[model samples]
Target: MATEHGIPKLRIVEPSFDSPLTSVIIDLEKLRDNRLDSKTHPGIFFQIKHIFQLLESLGSARIEGNNTTIAELVEKEISGSRNDDEIIGDDEINEIRNAERAMDFIESRIKNNSKIDQAFILNLHKIVVE
Candidate 1:
């Protein structure tokens, strides 16, 4: 089946334990298990996560040809102003906001052990495009 973007639907493949890449995967898992714990306070960690989400949204917008910089977005956000000129258009700002809304939708809908399916992806696409 084809997706809205005309790409083939994703097929989940199970990895064989005997594959040559198995050892590399096992090593990565071990590294993940041995990772150091964060020393930041929970509140600070949450703030950092929020900042990362904003950065991620900006990066996604940039990938889609939105040239608005992080500083421009942050300044607009802080000032609550929307007087964008030739450099940054309203559509560009809206694209970043839509990406952020998509992230929020994922956070609110998804939980531990939740399965992401085609419906979820389509809903996410709707959020990003709206």
Candidate 2:
């Protein structure tokens, strides 16, 4: 494979059924480089940025608001502990619905042998969590 933009070559190892599954250590730096060009692609950016922003905001919120607001938000975001009527805004509710729809779509695609990757999962996570 050819390297692009200082990107390292991808190392794909195919294992035989006779052999035990071998370790395939991934180089995160290479992975990052491979995906860098997708930042401009809205589909990829939507999910990646959502996670990145959520994490960044949570970090910032802790520094600024400390445990009070940040903790509550984190709990509400992760679990269904929060009262839906109060905590879930209009947009957030829509996001949840959209996430479910996207997941279903992905399942269907994979069933039909037309599947997506990180972009799909990222979008789903972003929708539900962010």
Q: Per-residue lDDT tens digits of candidate 1, residues 1-130? A: 7685887777776679998788888889889768568889989999889899889999999998989998888888788574322224478888888888888878877745456877889999998887
What is the Å distance of residue 24 in model 1 from its true position? 5.5
Superposed on all Cα atoms, the candidates' RMSDs to the truth, in angstroms, are 5.5, 15.1
What is the clash tally of candidate 1? 0
* Backbone clashes under 3 angstroms, per model: 0, 0
* Tens digit per residue, CA lDDT, model 2, 67-90: 434345556668875443353454
> How do all models score by TM-score?
0.68, 0.27
Runs in model 2 deviating more than 4 A are: 1-10, 13-89, 115-130
